[model samples]
Target: MPSKGVRVFTYIAVAGCSIELSVPKQTVVRNELNTFWNGDLEVDARNIDSLFNKKGRFSFKVLSNGRLVTEQWIDVNAITGNASGGTMDTIASTPSVFSPNNDNIIVTYGFYEAGQGHDVLPNQHQCYIAVAPNYANWQGKLAPPGSAQEGKPFNRLVLPSAHDVGMNSMQSSDSVLKKVGGAIATSLVGSHEAVAQITDSVSGPAISLVAPNIIFSLAITQKDSLDAMLQIGARYFEFRPAHCHKTILAAQALPDRLYFQHSAIPGMAYDQFLSDAVAFLLAHPAEIIVVQLRWDGVPAECARPSDQEQREYLDAALKQAQGQIVAGGLDDLRSSTIAQLRRNKKRLIMLVSVDSLSTYTDAGNATLNGDSIVAAFPKVLTAANERGKAFINIQCQATAANITEAVVYSVLDAGTTTSCIMATKAICDSKTLPWCRDNVLRTCDNNVLVVMMNDFIDGATADVAVQLSKQRLEQ
Candidate 1:
């Protein structure tokens, strides 16, 4: 896992005014009409009160190998004391000027006074845009109302999802291993001789220490943050919440002491995962996301909270992210359109287990149970599709085999050659979007709604989903 390096740049203007440009290191675009290249621009003019209510202009320019392709200017009034930012989705090229053969397409933007010239900003803020024969908006290109696919139900839409969405920061440390070992030791002490032998072994303490690292390595299924995942067009996220290690060891029923987990290993804190989801929803007005929460990886010795207690904990968390969740029962939401959800400003849908559906409902949040959604492993897609569920999740990662291989490598190679990332990439690449487009989508019936990928997910998967959506619209 080598670093991709930093790709952000900032420029300070006069009088405390500043502009920050954020774009992908490389964007793949198709040279066609109505195609867009998207980026983010943040403008700050609050430091100078004289600029309040004054007009400022944001200019976006695209050039292909030193030749101008397109330029757009947007005028805005500086708020009295607030920083303003928005997603810039501008046409990258027209059919007459751009083609698949073009290269070195640079996308750049700048902000200046309404009447200032384009030369006001420096030239260091440009990013390369790659030209390709096929392109799609990997972030968001939802089918709007009145389109042919507008009336399509949730089950028919091809939504990209992240498997183990919270495992972006899995770590292997002494503190983490201790908690994991404690959980395993508590669960299988009497039933398994190996567990007792490992606990009683003093001469082989290193074996006990290294065992958890093997588990942690295979537990990680994602490496990108939730914000980055959303930016690349992941519309569904699966979060598994388990008791924090300390709370589990103490045998306490603390509702708030939870972390997102992959089996026994914890990744991101539960509160932080929720906050990130809320922020993304607030920033993207036209996008809709589905969140599925499962109670997993709790040790046998820990005291599980009552359903009412779980409800109270989740209700408090949802309050912090209020107004973004879609409010309706399972039946109503299943039939609703993407446009309908966005127009109502309710863009998030939460799916819980049957036992917790009432818990979420009592809190006045829109919630559904397993009946409306079906999550299947890659091997069981055909069977799962037969259920005719409204939202079918095809988790493409093979967890058991991946963990077994990781454990075997750790033992044979002394943990030197074993890598969670390499294993995940091998599996994900085998089932990439292009592969899925032909083997899964084309072969499976119309029940495949969400295609969830494992670690190293990027815009390429979103590009396929966008293309599929467009094809559906045309049909």
Candidate 2:
């Protein structure tokens, strides 16, 4: 974060939702800067008490390898030829003596005219910040009785410290001026109270910091550099961000409060997850589980299943269980998905997740390839309606697929050479299957299956399991 700068507010909200949220604005400041390195420097002074009225100026310059040379000063009122003669007791001029150790410039006071009592501030006010590395010198008359045009002074290398406290200050007041800049600003009387504003910009000299490519080298020595391993896609009958204990307690205590995790796509659509969620609800009979999808805040990418598919799932669930459906998050589904889910019953409650949906600002053009994804919503609803099944849209848009945590995929392993070839074919065929298109799959050995499989049969090969599931489904 910059040590000194202005902060602005930006509102980031759920895409397409009317809700507005405020986020902090921050800018990184460079540690190495050139503004103070060079001998050339310009200063603008202003009076705060009187509508921020008053003008003063000063200049300085430094040489390469830390050398100082040529300094100048100017009074503003003198240029106007006012009887005041730009005379201000507070004004002090220090010149001569090169190579000063001082790299910083601080102006505490401004010029004040006699009889004015520092009370009546001049109408003109100005402050500036400019940088030129040994390129140019200060401008304007050093002693007055001259024009504003002053040629560049001694310069060989190095630049002055870019930090312009005065510039930053004025910029500060300018921001406030903006909010009230128009008629309201005009209505408010400007105050003149010796307010000095400065805008400081600092940057460090270029130096080598740890580079990304050097991570492995650092890891060998830095014990703390190692990253922790996180298990992904573990089923959570009850789940929480940090722990599942609380959710587990709810499940145990309330039996009726069931929780299910469905694959979720953040920022876009969650119909797939939602479909499974609704199916789970229908199958659980009297259970209302909180259906959640680990949606990465991205857009949806799936073809709408045909009515026949929806009928099969919904009809199966209705025959076995009785429950309501809830849906939210536009990625979970836009507002329309709620209406679709509600068509089946009054029990269905549509709940939107705070972050499940986002607009263009998120994934940009990638969020919605065309209105095609958007167009699929109605088709899904139509399918649900035909089956006499209720739907629920849970609005929780999560964008987490960037990591391996979104899904826990087990590697299919084969036993005999014959089984290996069959497993390879089945896995290969699954890749082209619509349901597996976005999923990751790989073949492994029996050793891997021993560690990963929860329901391990002593002699079943990976191919056998696929075959078994297929046969069972057919039955």
The top-ranked prediction according to TM-score is 1
Which portions of model 2 show Cα errors greater than 4 Å? 1-304, 322-357, 360-475
Task: Write down the TM-score of every candidate.
Answer: 0.56, 0.16
Compared with the true structure, what per-residue lDDT tens digits does model 2 show for residues 222-298? 00000000001111111111111232223332122111111110011123223444554454322122222232221
> How well does candidate 1 match the true structure in TM-score terms?
0.56
lDDT of each: 0.42, 0.19
Residue 174 Cα positional deviation in candidate 2, in Å, after optimal superposition: 60
Q: Which residue runs of candidate 1 sit more than 4 Å off their true CA positions?
A: 1-140, 145-151, 171-203, 208-212, 245-248, 251-256, 296-298, 302-310, 317-324, 327-329, 354-385, 400-406, 411-417
Q: How accurate is candidate 2 locally (lDDT)?
A: 0.19
